[model samples]
Target: MMFDDLDATVKALFDDAAAPAELRAADISFDTPDRAYKPAQATVNLFLHEVCENRALRDEARVMTRSGDRYTSRLPALRVDCAYLATAWSAQAGGLKAAEEHRLLGLALRWLSRFPVVDERFLRGSLRTPPQPYPLSTTVAQTQEGRSNAEFWSALGVPPRPAFSVTVTMTVDPFDEADELAAARRLHLDSTVMPHAALAGRVLDHTLAPVQGAEVTVVETGARTASAMGGEFAVPGLAFGDYTLRVQPPGGPAEQLAVTYAADHQRLTVVLSQP
Candidate 1:
């Protein structure tokens, strides 16, 4: 179920693209092009071969929304790359088979190249309904790391054919629900209203260097703030309580620490390992 919506969206892209008469009747398939597989008719096969995190587009900032008296903080969605090996198959024999397959593959490439990013109109299932905030980036005929074409085909126990790699970058949310918290309230001492407690923190790497632009969040109150140039951050208007702080550096892993925010203990330090 991981890439179910993405898979459907990719298929929908192919289904909706305008094609020549020769490819109009050809079937679109997601099955592996292995040795035992043989198409009874002309087909376009997009076999999902690799999936991995796209670190270049990675974002660690939390998205926070405020309503009436409540706040909701959601972790940033992860950017992932889904790579597919696209190949064309034909049931015809000899020269005719090769010619048809080459033409179909060429047309498919042209159709896909038209859109560097998949259009929202072609999105399907969950990808279309609520709509993802991030764009679906696409790359055609790009070489992917970790595997060679010949080795991949050999592993599938099939002869290598003319194929191109298509990698689609999509977002996946780690949490289904956002963390909710009530608005922080001020304390009253006799006739005077005391200021609300605030948590101040600093972010640093294992080398003790300040990490700027790091996101810091108070788990219990959904209070969020970004570290300054000196890795300093302050979350204002927080009620005194025991809380867990989540610190995420840009393009780095997230780290959490148990903390207590009181009148005397309002500041802390967090060290994040280099990614």
Candidate 2:
């Protein structure tokens, strides 16, 4: 799981020998710090308390990648914030336990606070080779706004302990590859511009077969064209107004219908009666 990788990454941050020997020797854990859980060794518990979308880093743009002859457009990766509650635990009793825990917690805070952005070397597992192209962002010892510490501890059935929040922002790409589009090899420019709107449609017979070579005309403008193969026809340079459309099938009777032509009135389907 991604969280498991994140846990490993966090643990890696404390694995350096340069840190205090006590801190390096302390065990790193990603477990629920509940009342029932008791550790026999000095442990730094990292409980993932919240997972949410980092709206502040939301990206609406799409990412485009071009292959040899095709290109794909995919939505940008989502930025997610994983917040962890970091606390220290020691097996010692009374004041010794509290002091050791505090010392470990302080050392952890010092180590974590140094990296606002996780170093690439410290990233572990899938995080080390993230699919998305965003760096892991970190926030240390910051006050998180969501669930209060008291409520969080209460939910875990444990008393509140001294702890700091560690938030790491990671990227998730959940969508499959977008449809690929073939590359355009050539461009055609049409210089003959129509001063007015155009109308287009297809001609079909009663049985829904294409009626090629049928004459179609706009009665008001006298614009006319013959339906080509596949029953497609177009009449350009027509004013925006009401007009009567007349369609005459080859060796067949003519049909007339009224239509209102506007810029958006682009298509019409003319179906002829069966012989």
Q: Number of the top candidate by TM-score?
A: 2
lDDT of 1 by residue, 1-275 (tens): 65777888777766773746566578888898898889999999999999999999888898888999899999988888999999999999999999999999998898888779998987877777677889899999988577678888988987899999899988787788889988777765531122545788679899989999999988887889999999988898887788999998998888988998888777778888665
Q: 1-275 in candidate 2: lDDT tens per residue?
A: 88899899888888976777898899998888998779889999999989999999998989888999898988888899999999999999999999999999999999899889988888888887754388898999887567567888888887899999999999888888696788888998732333455787789999999999999998887889999999988888776788899999999999998887776676778888756
Candidate 2 at residue 114, lDDT? 87
Clashing pairs in 2: none
Segments in model 1 whose C-alpha atoms lie over 4 Å from true places? 145-147, 183-275
lDDT of 1 at 94: 100
Q: Model 1 TM-score?
A: 0.64
Please list the C-alpha lDDT of all candidates, in the order they appear: 0.85, 0.87
- What C-alpha lDDT, on a 0 to 100 scale, does residue 24 get in candidate 1? 59
